[model samples]
Target: MQHLLQIFILYLFILKIFGDNVDENFPQYPETKQLYETYDFIIVGGGSAGCALANRLSEIENWNVLLIEAGGEENKRLMDIPGLALQNQHTYFDWCYMSEPFEEAGLSLINQSICVPRGKVLGGTSVLNHMVYHRGAPADYDRWENVFGNPGWSFDNVETYFKKLEDVAIDSPSLPDYFGKNGPLHVECAEYRSKLYPAYMAAAHEAGIKSELLLGPNQIGVECAWKTTKNGYRFSSNRAYLVPIRRRNLHLKLNSQVTKILFKGNVAIGVEFVCANQTYTIYSKKEVILSAGAINSPQLLMLSGIGPKQHLAELKIPLLKDLPVGQNLMDHVAILGLQFEINESPNVVEDKDMQLKEFLYNQTGPLSSYPAETIVFSHLSNGIPQYEDDFVTSTYEQQNHELYHFSSETWAEAFLPNNQSKGAFYIYPVLFKPKSRGSILLRDNNPFSHPRIFLNYLTHPDDISYLVMGIREILRISEQPSLQAFGTTLYKNKLRACKQYEFNSDDYWICQIRHLSTSLFHQSGTCKMGPKDNLDAVVDAELRVHGIEGLRVIDASIMPEILAGHINGPVIMIAEKGADIIKQFWANRKVG
Candidate 1:
């Protein structure tokens, strides 16, 4: 214990020194003079999509592009450490927005409001996310084309863009050729290499689940997730797509908060922003693309007079076009902190000594891997009456959807007040596609104040029902022979709120889920993209704003429907495809 304390102290000392020299290590942006200058393309919010767009658009030598970010560079040593990913929340790089108190959802939180963390730095959420690189199911995309009226967004059409952005680090020759071979982003299976992983896989198989580790578009089995990491560091969008490329055509403005979109009638002309405590306006001759993520994107739109008319009238803001800017807000809400005790902690060769050596020498170790390594994607209901067509259909619109099971190391320090050294693991049951839809609303017309967020999680009874069923499935998995070999058992932590009901009963689990349910940080679908005539649709199939010209929303906010996977990868793909669409439109204009 004393040795561990010394190591920790040394770690903090190293971090302090490293933090001081951040500006010298990370990429330097050009100094900003004044803002109102005109550029051919002005991409707001230097996030995952914004970074990709800036990189891709700047490829055209003649086109002048400006990328603006609300937060400064993420050069902190903490951002580079993969294990410290969760710690970045509510920190300097995070927007740290909180959701409005829930009426129908979030029954368990302190004030019934959940914390929403968004990236405010150069790479946006990509710099702060869990680094899980999932592309979602193919059927998810087909639904976008067939049901949502987006023709070019089918799995086949968008796969090329997915391939174009990734450089797969995993050497699985036996797997299908869906993965990208030559791309800028570095993706690899985390090097956790725990013995518990194999046992978990075996347990799933014993329970009639033939699981396969997949990195491509399909996610039908149990596997260790592929991550956006190179070596032991977090491979954020800025690192993968922006840093290496030296483009003189692109100008990046850091700490620039866009207040409103400057518009003339229906056409977007420029943006009014605050930088270094000074206000300025910048015009875009071509288009003003919004990639400010799910929360800020919609808030910015509404602030600029492009949202629901009724809401805008209350604030006395002149309405540009009456559109739902913050409606259809969707996220993957999960039941987190489900603990299970094993017979003994698995043999992790060189827990401290080897870890420090490996990280220093080659940047490889358990620290390199994300805390949650294994994930199981399975349909909640098979043919059981409880999981029947009606129950399943009532849960979500997807014909076939899977619940995400995250098996992770459950450090007792996070939960237990007494024994902080207890060995345990966690099983998080995540509702991928929920029936309940929420909204984002303006708190006031103030651009600096955070918009009121309504993440109506588990509003539908079926959402809670699915989660209850997932608990049952987890219990069954624990009972499997493979898991039984480790003497796996649920960690019986006393829940003061759920003590009235019998432990492990349906009612008790339901109570626990409601109180503990929080976001997976996969917030999306506020500015929905669909057919222009659809009243709820904010953007069209081409990602252009409905009833507006020279404007586009090319971020997670524009997702017509949230995919059944982590959003970072798909968000990048949207930017890649959106950039191509912009280039094509320019070429056609020249031809005309």
Candidate 2:
């Protein structure tokens, strides 16, 4: 009895001597926060999905989670304000990466220069985007089942997951589909949209288009602005996911760049990084889930010698896995800043200071978020016909299947979209499913080096036609009487405006696009998801990388195609569901 008492006392003394009574809600990085010294799980890239997974996994209390993030936390004041999302673009929280300049573009973005602002902070890209909460069309995931061999990834399965992460505070009551109460993430609507919104919708209706409530019974029509904002603040994944479950059990590493994934045969053993000036190697007992975005995920895989053999040989890196690592990259490219001198300034941009002040005081302001007040999910006049299996790339064995499909056949398939566009009500469109595909390759073996991202935009002749058709649609909407009411003529007055409105030929539309094209900012499919038969797929339906064990890829990278709407919401749902899948698998294995 005395010995047992002595042992108990000794244990208590040791715990009091070393254990942290640290506040559970406070932030701690993996480099700094080590509760049990080693964790049960290690999640890489603490972005939208990564944080959510980490938070949920840490709920076990005794279980430890080590979350590795290249960026620091930005889910605070500046990032939480919807209006300030753009300001963080050039700040330290942003991984401000630019594309190799293209001569065709009017240097507005870069000489072919595409500036990609990745979140170098806790919430990842969610900290940078306009925070729109679009679940996309139900048919989106249905198509995943139809096109790929992914059986259970339909909307029915994913909707619950979406609800699990979100606690939506919809400002508009007429909006159907209430947000879940017990969810972690907060979603709200945009407070202030440019006055151009109404005219934009009216013009779409006038052009024979219809509106479809995004989360309602269907997704085949025009929509409304529903962003992930609460009141007037941005509701990032970190705010909803990581911050809530931050305790000693969960370690978050920031300002740490993962150098390599140390593997033993097929099992991923651990990861190494350059932190501050020192290098650190952290082992993962359970797994290393990669939540790096479309660009970086593939880049990391390739740097770890998991890409194509030819590409690896070129870079002189030994190939670890020959399966396609950086193939089938797809993104949406749109024309930006189509000018219609506002009849009256929507003033969202002009009154930035007052809006900021009001927000700072009470977190309420018009400019708090984009009043994507009305969203339209319409097919382009030049868009691929809504035939079944249009985006099915699973059976195709070719590397450029998507590119060839988009570049070749679209010329005769599309119409001259109505260009009589309205000037107000904030008009922005998302191409439902683009056929164009791209790839990522390492410039060198160095993990710190930026990889080469070739979007191969408009590589397909059909792609050019659709882009041209999109230009014509923009022209059509701009020509509407509602838009013209504000001296906002939609006729091509691009800096490289068509020489004559009457001579608006295909060449003119093409030239206008080449000059004014903007990235709709959806980069996807770099690390595609599907079965083993999917030649270009990097991970299976379970999101497990093809040739590795105890490793998973969850992020925008695993998307099979560019969804019809913003992919962020869907990506969050994926992470949420993935956490469950992983948890259940581990639980069952433990029982066994």
Candidate 3:
């Protein structure tokens, strides 16, 4: 125990030493800078992708890689608390950009976009997310490779990289074989459970469905959630990739915003950034990679004159690559949320003073970062058989021999609405793959102006149809025998009855959804990766912007399509693989 404590203290000390260097107030580089030679690689956006790239690229001692972030270093406090993420939104720590107005959202934004809050801190969204670590259905990656024509990006091919980035935080016996042990990001058990978790699972079972791992034998089942946490702490990319070795060689620049990429003809020579009273330019000798996530990535690209010709012409931004930069914005949009109640449990909102004390005192209890209780995955469509995605639950059976049983065909994952929740319980019915696609545009030339996020949500006729089907399923599960005992209530006076039960108005059910709908926040696909001839293709399989040199995009923006689950896990893996790709590219350059 003493040895373990020593190791833990050592880790914290090292992280603190590294993280201490980041400061918006850190003596700003003089306006008239002492010009250095050049770095071999320059990665923009110190979010998930950027951090991974920097960590991986720096592995080569000879390779001088510079990572430039527009945000501050990782805040250990925020890194360890899950529920506080929402509270940080719109603060100095967040970009706090609102979306362009929308009509479908009931004129919520007056046709103005809604608020978009992305982390401006070290870990990026990972620091701000609910921390449910789900690597979407395997089929999604297979489709991604097909769409982008990349041989190595297939689910099977990318599995190795995923394993390399993930460290399961659960006991060995409780995990599947595919999960790894010594990875960077720690994926642990549900941080805090809700009163409804067990009932939700039991109710699903009562309805003839089994509580099993969605990634198990079949993807049709229901199961609990697996989060991206470590030792009861939030595990963002900054935590895994940045905090350990930040002070070593990384020139992490916070409160520094990139204005434009300086190019000599087609080659990106350096970048211009505004620090305080003055602007500065940093040079990159070999490459400039963008990892500013889905929204900012495209916005930056367009600002640099690398988007569609007509769009740039209208915006008066010079056209560098007329290549659909912000065309295909996709997000995991879910109808608001459905709420349930629990009279007995001590809800997360009940006691904040105590919770804060718990965190600061013993480092145990609700203060731990594991926010969401559990997340269940299932394929609910037209009586479809469960599709075996990436995850599967393996178990041991009787007889000196252990028989493996899969638990994914029918499952339900529930989170007890702890302090992290807003008093009531919310079940967000996520539509993994929606036909609807949105667009991200430059609201104006001002880098601080919020981008126009025209999320013509439900624009695809089928998207709402699937949602209606999911609402119906949500209602069905609520009425299951097990849940009936819990006295769980629906939105209102039974709008649409279960198939075997009574019925109501279609409009009524739709109304319930609109009123309850909330953002699952899995936004992506703006700078889409696809085959060269594809009209909306922004980058190729190599993650290289189609028509540009010395520039590549390496964030969720490159996702050609949305996945079957949460995007955090996949994005982390993408960064890990991207690092390898960049490393190999440079290595071969030397070899050749």
lDDT of the candidates, in the order given? 0.77, 0.65, 0.64
TM-score of each: 0.90, 0.82, 0.82
lDDT of 2 at 332: 71
Task: Estimate, for each residue in 231-259, the C-alpha lDDT of model 2 and write its tens digit.
Answer: 66677787778665537777777879888
Q: Pairing residues by index, what is the TM-score of model 2?
A: 0.82
| Model 1 stretches with alpha carbons more than 4 Å out | 1-12, 15-36, 174-176, 347-358, 380-414, 417-422
Candidate 1 similarity to native, TM-score: 0.90
Candidate 2 wrongly placed segments (more than 4 Å): 1-32, 35-37, 101-109, 171-181, 193-196, 348-352, 380-429, 479-481, 491-504
Residue 566 displacement in candidate 1 (angstroms): 0.7
Instruction: Arrange candidates, best TM-score first.
Output: 1, 3, 2
CA RMSD per model (angstroms): 6.6, 12.8, 10.5
Q: Report how far off residue 383 is in candidate 1 (Å).
A: 15
Q: How many clashes (backbone N, Cα, C below 3 Å) per candidate? A: 2, 47, 35
lDDT of 1 by residue, 1-592 (tens): 2333443565676566545432234565553455438999999999999999999999999999999999988663557677556556666778978888876555545566787889999999998888988787777787888889988999898999999998987666676577887887888878766657777778777877666654554455677777898767898998877788776788888988999999998999999999778998899999999999999999999999999999999988899999989999999877754666665655374356566556555666666776566667767322101210000000111111111111111222123332324345667787877888999999999999999999999888988988887778777777898878877767775656667899889998888887667788999999998998788899988899999999999999988877877889999999999999999999999999
Residue 95 of model 1 has an lDDT of 92
- Cand. 1 Cα-lDDT: 0.77
